[model samples]
Target: MPSPTMVASFRMLSSQRPFLRHIRHTPHWPGKWPTVSHARQLTTGSRELEGDSPQPERPKRRQKLRKIRTLDPTKLSPRDYVDFSMLRQPNVELVAQSSDLNDASNALLGRLSATINARGIRDGKFPPNTAGFLYYHTPPYSPPLAGEVRFRITPSPDTASLSEGNDLLTEYGIPWKIPLLHMTDKKGYTGLQTLLLRDGLVTPQLLDIATSISKSVKTLSRIVGGA
Candidate 1:
């Protein structure tokens, strides 16, 4: 019951199959089909080209070190050395036996060493030896060589200096002791040695001389009294 036109169309399509098949089998790239060896060579060539191409250089990695903050000895609390060992002379052998004590000692020493190197001695450098018997030594403690000796070190500003009401001399005009200079009767005292004991002027050198003089005076007094 097929229509004449439909039947004719179907026959035309069937007749074109062989032509289509020939077209499909023909190489579309204008060459014969590649053999197994030719295919291998093509793949190897592509690989070689890839290998020969310049590669991007990787960036060098650097190790970042952590910067440690230094500890301030002045800021250290008394509790830090509460049960801590480390004491004077002949008993020096008994120092830093415990792990806590040892760690504390090492930390203290390291900080002290760094501090001394930074600003301890004269411009962080030792003085040149004048005498033949000058001792190059380090003390167990570093005290303020100049200025008034203070037992307590705190970050808080001195309240006495800050207080306006504390200035009694300014308000009441109170009398204060002043430094005195004693002169010998001799007109030209070439052998006279002057010493200053003001809080600002007193130094270790002056202190040592004063101590020796005091001892000598006491010894002389004792001898004279016995006579």
Candidate 2:
């Protein structure tokens, strides 16, 4: 067994060992020591305020798009991607509604312009009475005629003007041809009539006309000024 003095001496040295080791190993920073960093990411505003080590620059926020990218055309919205109001409706008809005589004249020209009618299909030509004039239909009214509709303002080419001149042209209809559906008669006008009939567009009026050509002539005359 060791003496009490020696035992006391050993305990004293053992206690001092830890203290000496800590003094020798204590870390010393050469410059100002750093403070605790934030647990969350810091932004430019935060860096300015906190004065801590700079965080990695935050990725820029994504930008928005004018239009969505998609394979489906039906999903597209025309109003968004395009300048909707900026588009021109050149093919659409514009006319004065107050002109009764002008409107009547246009109606007659339209009837004459019929290439496919109750009578059948004719050579797609405007009649001789309509020769000097040209006709156009408002796209909205002329197409897929869900019900009866009116013709557009007739284009009268001035006789004083030519295609080369503005003054010499005076026809109300165009020289260019437009394909239109017409009616039929008992005689059954042309193959186009059969096609339209097969397609079921030769409405009840034409069937009546076919059943009674002379009888329906009055209805025709009333509508077109002559059978």
Candidate 3:
């Protein structure tokens, strides 16, 4: 029913399909074929699909310790009595009881402190002693001292120095330098002396000294007591 010229044009266009197929199948085709990919893959990932911005490598925090030192709750050794009786007559009592000389010294100091405190003195660390202060003297021993193999027995800064304010005075001040006429005092003696009142009551001699001081007040008053 169509004119011959129009019919011929339609046939010509239809025949080009095989020629186009041949061009696409050629190895030298300039177009790159799409790479086969797993169904899980997409050309572009959605924002949500990316792992949360590599959790911005959280600024490393210094490891915190729950407790600076984990002390053995078990009693290391029973208290031993140290005699100061030999130093004086009428030995009334053992001056102190402690596991070691350090503890004994501490006990003696505690007694001394009580006596002084009773007389209304609020002086701080009357005698400062830090050499054997339980913290700095924990050297490892051949036979484990008194417990199972322990870890971090010594105190940690996080636990020991939590109160930042305490060190402010120490940091800014002369910083715990011992005053002296050189080599006059042992570190142990100097340190333990602070706890002198921990065990014993004030001696009678101290009371006598106090009485003398009170009586002498009148003489001093006459010198400075202007008419």
Candidate 4:
């Protein structure tokens, strides 16, 4: 009963039904109509939007370094105690005046040299009385002497016989007097006194001789000890 043109138009409408339904369910469509190109454009736009979405970037981690501490030599005060047993043989001589090569008093020089040498050899140790030898050259230039004149021991070359008294017994008698020679002042005593006291009481002359011998012994000890 329908006309031919109307029937053709109905067939065309039936063919587009699926497309119309698809467009009706799609988002952002102008109307219930669809085209192949429009569908392709929508799919491409969706892909582009997904690609442009932002994602969080991860944070970078840093490496930790270790701290180092440095030492200060000046701030480090090392207290050193000298061992006499390790002393080597020392050069010994008595001098009368202060000369370039001969600047030490004969008696003082002889006494020191002998004392240091003998003790080193006999006891295999430096006599405690002569401990001052290690620090004789150290400062403060003049240390506490218990209110006595501070004398600095210097090296000398003038030779003198023990039998003949010299400046040591005359002018510097306080330091050179025999150990038995009593003095009100304790500061005037020499290393020989202490050494003798440790062993036993002896004549001042004998102590002096012994001290000189010790100095000689110390010089030999130094050589042998080193070997």
lDDT of each: 0.31, 0.33, 0.30, 0.36
Candidate 4, residue 172: lDDT: 24
Which tens-of-lDDT digit does each residue in 1-227 have in candidate 2?
89999999999999899777776666643234334452233355566688666779889965232221111222222221211111111111112112456544334322221221211113323233221222222245443322121211122333232232211111343323223322333232233233333334444565454446545665777889743
Candidate 4 local lDDT, 1-227, one digit each (tens): 99999999999999999999888777777665658898898899999999897778898864222111101111111121112323433332222222445533333433432222332134343223332112111125643221121111222211111113221212324342222222111233354343233223334555455556556666798999999
Best by lDDT: 4
Model 3: weakest 10-residue lDDT segment is 113-122
Over 1-227, each residue of candidate 1 has an lDDT whose tens digit, in order, gives 99999999999999999988887677653246778998898899999988997889999874322111111223222222211011111000111112454455434332221001111222333222210110011124633222111112122223222222221111124311111111122212111111122112344464455446556666798999999
> Least accurate stretch of 10 residues (summed lDDT) in model 2?
82-91
Off by over 4 Å in 3: 1-32, 36-56, 69-146, 149-227
RMSD of each: 26.4, 22.1, 21.6, 28.3
The C-alpha local distance difference test score for the whole of candidate 4 amounts to 0.36
TM-score of each: 0.19, 0.19, 0.17, 0.16
Instruction: Give model 4's clash tally.
Output: 20
Candidate number that wins on lDDT, 1 or 2: 2
